[model samples]
Target: MMERTALISVNDLNIDVALRQAALGDRVLDLTPKGFDLLLFLAMNRGLVFNRKQLLEKVWGYDYAGDTRTVDVHIRWLRKKIEADPGKPKRILTVRSVGYKLEG
Candidate 1:
């Protein structure tokens, strides 16, 4: 059976992420194809850390030839839109040397 996609809100951020519409709350988020894919992946698997390489492969649909730093760049953009304070992120967290995890 096909499941309906619903809005995903983490914490009390007052924001809703609808993967179908690629939106964040009432405001439309202008995310790149890769950026959106990354966010959706993290959101679906919230609280679970995935390393850069893993994210790249899963989201990019292959083992990317690019550097893992791409994940950091996209994370930075996502925070600017979703995080209360992008500088000190709460929703998307950096797990030291491991990877990032969505704090759902």
Candidate 2:
């Protein structure tokens, strides 16, 4: 029997958590460690909005000493890789003062 792999799909984006890989159609995306973690978390949660603090703790761990703005930078990078138009993002939506959420 073939082993079934776990996958998170949001539109054209496909993430393989087990392999720690993400791809847009046939092209594999080059994601940083933090960037991949953030994407995996958001993709798993789907529509739930998570604040910077929450993201830092979840994606970067509670021991992280960096500013919450790190999340913003990662989010921006992720949008560029995933969204057809990073300027007008469709997958990762900003909740303004609240934070961000992945629209699956």
Root-mean-square deviation (CA) per prediction:
3.3, 1.0
lDDT for each residue of candidate 1 in 1-104, tens digit (9 for 90 to 100): 98765666555433234444455456767777777777778887899999988888898868479888888899999899788899998889999999999997
TM-score of each: 0.79, 0.95
Pairs that collide, model 2: none
Q: How close is candidate 2 to the true structure, as a TM-score?
A: 0.95
Candidate 2: C-alpha RMSD after superposition: 1.0
Error of 2 at 46 (Å): 0.7
Cα error of candidate 2 at position 47, Å? 0.7
**Model 2 lDDT per residue over 18-97, tens place:** 89999999999999988999999999999999999999999999999988899999999999999899999989999988
C-alpha lDDT of residue 102 in model 2 = 98
Question: For model 1, what is the error of residue 35's alpha carbon versus the real structure, in angstroms, after optimal superposition?
Answer: 1.1
Q: lDDT, candidate 1, residue 96?
A: 97
